[model samples]
Target: MFAIVFILLLFSTGDSILIGKIQNSTIIDVTHISLFNITLNQCICKLITVSGIIPAANYFPGNQSCQLFNFNNNSSLISSNFNTYWIFTNQSSAFITNTSITSTSSPTTSISSSSTTTSTTTSSTTSLSTTSTSTTTSSSTTTTTGCTNLGMFPYQSTYSVGVSPQSVAVVDVNSDNKPDIIVANFGSNTVGVLLNVGNGTFLSQTNYSVGSAPESVAVVDVNSDNKPDIIVANTLSTNVGVLLNTGNGIFRNQTTYAVGTQPWSVTVSDVNNDNKPDIIVANFGSNTVSVLLNAGNGTFLTQTTYTVGTSPMSVAVVDVNSDNKPDIIVANSLSNNVGVLLNTGSGTFLGQVTYITGTNPKSVGIVDVNNDTKPDIIVANYANTISVLLNRGNGTFLNATTYLIGLSPLSVAVVDVNSDNYPDITVANSLSNAVGVLLNT
Candidate 1:
């Protein structure tokens, strides 16, 4: 005589793949008893239950009241009031009991003609089971197809800069959605601009003359105009060069402004929150950061110098303290540390605080590397290493984690090259005569 028993098993969705379910069976002794409760409000809850049971056998669903067997026939069958579902994989086929028979029987399982169904049966009996029959649907897995291996920083292609490319900036020129590149050619006394071709490649580079020995470049919209302007630090000329954008990837001739001696890096931001952008240049020769207040017509007033550590080679602007005011961070190469200048909201800076770093820190970039919402600092040390300083959300940083890179890395830029939602590091290796990319893992 055939006996009918009802059992309910909870299956959650996780990393486990659903195989097939068994129905209308008398459950045997459930030795490894565990309880899991789930509300049937949605299909996601059921998927979660199945996910928890993967790589393991047997799961109890519905309050601690339901008992689920491991599909073994060694124990006696019992009657249950709860509804039960059996999920199995090809490896667990040997343990599955016949669906209609209370006794032990070898059953054969096969993939059904329908893509989503699986069939199982014994020589003398046939039983059908369906795994997912709920009205709620779940999204399929999304994969970034055609992506290169996560850790492989394959060399894409490189364009030749003028003589010595000291620093680089990434921005969209010509209103293109892709990021173009600007390189400060120190030996050529000019800056090179490469328009991105929408793919990973760039168009032929166009060179724009600046003052003597341009060492750094920053792109911004300085004149309340939508077009991005270029700012260059002319190291030997001891001044800052501003090239107003005339639209469509074209820039007017350099408009020079006097600052402290030997300005090695340039960055632009609304320093006083006046809605008009201001310029900040790291003056290496004078050991100061020159703040040039913008006049809103692509011109700036005379610079006000703020003393910083020795030989500051790079400067980055960010609201490090979450104070809504833009602050400054400088990489002091000779001092072997980074200096933080807090914005006092009046276009003036408070006394600087120094954070120790590796030898000859050349460049600094801000990015949220850990997805923590706080901006962290990435520094290129001339001593053959790159350092990552995690932000503490209070304008301070935790200890740095350093990674070895090519020899004499002079500059760094962060970009998401693989569309992987993680920022990768690109370094200009001065002595190596090559650009090194560190793929984010």
Candidate 2:
């Protein structure tokens, strides 16, 4: 019984050459192979095993078998009843194969000789059977290593609230160190409180009845009692509701104070520098921001209305010019811009300076996004984007960078949710019926 083995080396022109072969050798090592020629073409080497004789005559046939073997510098010869042949090529031919021939006691061998006469070369060849295997291993390693730096921010969880949660405020309502959430549920005509139970989770929400169609809620220590109270903007009732914190996650009956028509949002700050917290309301129907001076005992003086852009939907207080006086920033939904009302150290506001933003900007939040020590403005535009305006530190803002958010983003809040020290954004997506959290990179 005779078995035939065939080995084929195919390459593009000038890529590879068959230098020579060593025949009838008992032991073969890396030192026994030599390169005789060189080529300029880039080489690609592949080793494929074909069983039985092939149709081409270039491969040796009849009782000759080729087996895959690796040649290393420290390899030792294994005793076998076979003959070994080694072939060497140039540097471009990095792949090699070894053939073991089994024959009768005496075997006749023939050698085909060809002379180039142009150059003579001498270099050792090492069988690279594992070269292709190592290359594939490296490719797989690179693919997995590249994914480590692509940080992804996925939703942690969503806690269901009342119908149509239009606004949200994060505070410690029960004096717990963990931050709690208060939502103005417009459709339910109530304020919902979700106590934080730690680890980015919330307990079942508790609701308190307020005036009709509560659009916004703010937590503040209104009575100087060291306990945070809840203030709500009742849109349909055209009033502001003040709920005194009665301790232990409970609130007293809401005290309604009449403000401009269709009050949409409320913020608590010391607008007059009287060391007492005052309430500011954004009136959507009247196109004004109403300031209610705190009377120091859970009561507010008569509301004073200031003219702003059309349909003032949200309000924020900050020292826009670094003058130590709190200035007001309003997001005008109908005007498609933000109105900056600089405070004059008294209770009066200067004429409004408007900075254009995305269409139908609904809510605004202030944060130092660029680490420049000046607060920037982030607005949630109902036109399906979030606008970011960098502050120039002198009560004015530059052009906006708009990012596509969830459908119908009605409100936005900035907080560092991932502990990365950078501010992340949370938007109340009214149309999508979900809260969208965008983690800062």
Candidate 3:
């Protein structure tokens, strides 16, 4: 009977492969994703194949209800819960039943065949373990299984990444629809560049060696030549390096100029209010931020140096404390604060605001974490937690929520993982070896 159910489900999608389904939250392994269909609204979907079987259809009933279904080997219908009870059914018998419990439930089911189908679910902001599935079969035998969820009240879930990654700056030097990743390795002396392979996966193209170390990297048309250029802050080098992107990944005419001691971060902004992008370098070795006026050519002239706080590691240009012009926010790593530099609208700094944050900060990124119109600050700290600072738009940060994440997070990159119109965080944990992803609710 299980063999028949497996064959039917596998044949339903016109694929001859085994498929598996998750009842409630229980995960089963399938060999392929070709056998099941997935349908969901507002909830994220994840598909895993096990033992040569694919996953069954995933249906999101609504914001408050979710059901994972699959047919068992005995042609029984299986159901798992989002809020209440759990039950497993074969065409003729009940295998497992937990009626007294009242919580979200999950079950797993599987079958064997050949061929494949693909489907996806919407991403949520809740925490869920990563699911894996695989399937295997022999020439003479077949197997089928089912999982079910039976529950009461179901609510939409919010998913968070394991480590919050922010500070993603995309640029296509090759005119590809995809963007390349220029990561500023703060502690490491190299800048990691990952090329987009048109597909969803990113390939590490090359790592450029910069002096001392790099904190942040920005790509822009510095010469108005239509091609992008790379700007990196050599923290210990106490200078900024410009590498003009040469159609290929190789950079030429590498130029280095003094800005300040321990230049920790850099940003390209139109400081003169003339629409021409300018350069701002935050110095950590020195308590100052340097502004360089763009010469229209590929070179820059030092404009002025403004004193900031202690150990500024990150810089951002935003119109906070709005006065029609953009302001500068520097994440002071050692000071445990973010320094806001109010713009004078005339290429000068007027005043500054200091917002207290968590300890031993490494990097910072801005996003609308609470769905508010104003941007919030997500700080990745070496202290092992992420600090979410709500921007008041008046140069002040409201109460911050620090989320405990991976160990020794060095940087952050924010992107939409499931295309939910909301942003998620990805963290590059230096010591952890693997990148951690956090989905925002």
Candidate 4:
């Protein structure tokens, strides 16, 4: 019953779908996810679908242990070490004997419904080739949320994207609650949209042509529609392009707004409190930042430019001074520092003040580090370090406390990794080719 065995591995919720469960093994909690339950599929499905996380749920029928695993990117599935082998027991009998095997969903999906003995004579094994499964359907479906955890693990998969993909933003494009990916494909001169199809896989990437060499992408409802739209900083085109989400995952053609030279990054915020989203872009070549106030109906006035440090490559919006209004933060790469431009009333900003970072800062993020209501700054420096600059009450910041993390800290984000309520720092190390997570104490 390879056909029947394959149908029981799928896990699905409202819109959140697990990639697939690891074969027919009971979940061994190797990831130390202290989920105590006598029922098998209910606990794993609830843990995966309701948890908003895609942690690897490995199945080990023996002892009913659930496992969590980590795999590197661009690798194949390794089973003997990782324990993801499959087994298709003869299901003609009502009960399984000798071995430990568990399942999350009902197995009636692929079984014969005509007669009681009809499935009893079915062949139970198929050619699942090299991997350790006795006989399994390779591409079949079942109600499963278990992710593959071998090389990059099979579940944390990679989509063949356009060449030289740059900045990426995640949002639910379709009405489904599943998150989708929007990436700026710089080398291919387009934007790639990969939508989740509730199976472990995604629909083929839908690529939309935009301005030349799009470097960064952001999502916002620019036209006041609830549907989110795509915006990209076209570096070579020296402009910003907007792709309105017509409905579903579809988008209209590129509508261009000229900006400074080489707009490397872009972000959106309501700068004037007009309830409409505005665009902020970092012009790398021009050494300035442009604020495009959303005029009406997805259009912007001539950009209002503000001077910043040399080669401002990244832009972010945060209330850095506790002023309730959104302020701007830019990483001036050539200047090796970050510039903070405080917001004045009515879409205007004062002069930018400089704070030193490591050599060549590339990205910046805002988070409340010490539970101090005031937002602090976390910067990713290209020189193999992360700089944490704490806020000092008013609109200023203290000298940064730096940490050596990896080869090249290219990107940074803040999240509470261990559910400890304290924020943690994660970095994408470009040179070392790793992701480092520093937990908060």
On TM-score, the leading prediction is: 4
Measured with C-alpha atoms, the lDDT of residue 314 in candidate 2 is 87
Q: Write the per-residue lDDT of candidate 1 for residues 223-304, one digit (tens) a residue.
A: 9888889999999998999998888887889999998889988888999999998999999999999999998788999999
Give the least accurate 10-residue stretch of model 4, judged by summed lDDT: 116-125
Candidate 3, residue 314: the lDDT equals 80
* TM values, all candidates: 0.58, 0.58, 0.58, 0.71
Whole-model lDDT per candidate:
0.72, 0.70, 0.61, 0.73
Q: Quote the lDDT for 124 in model 2.
A: 20
Q: Which residue runs does candidate 3 get wrong by more than 4 Å?
A: 1-71, 74-170, 176-212, 246-250, 413-441
Better of 2 and 3 by lDDT: 2
- Candidates 1 and 2 compared by lDDT, better number: 1
For model 1, how many clashes? 15
Residue 260 displacement in candidate 2 (angstroms): 1.2
- Supply candidate 4's per-residue lDDT for 344: 98
- Please provide, for model 2 over 71-179, each residue's C-alpha lDDT reduced to its tens digit, 9 standing for 90 to 100: 3222233212234334443323433235333332332333224322221111222232111110000011111112222232223488888899987899988887888
Best by lDDT: 4
Off by over 4 Å in 1: 1-161, 170-172, 176-181, 193-206, 399-406, 413-441
Better of 3 and 4 by TM-score: 4
What TM-score quantifies how close candidate 1 is to the native fold?
Answer: 0.58
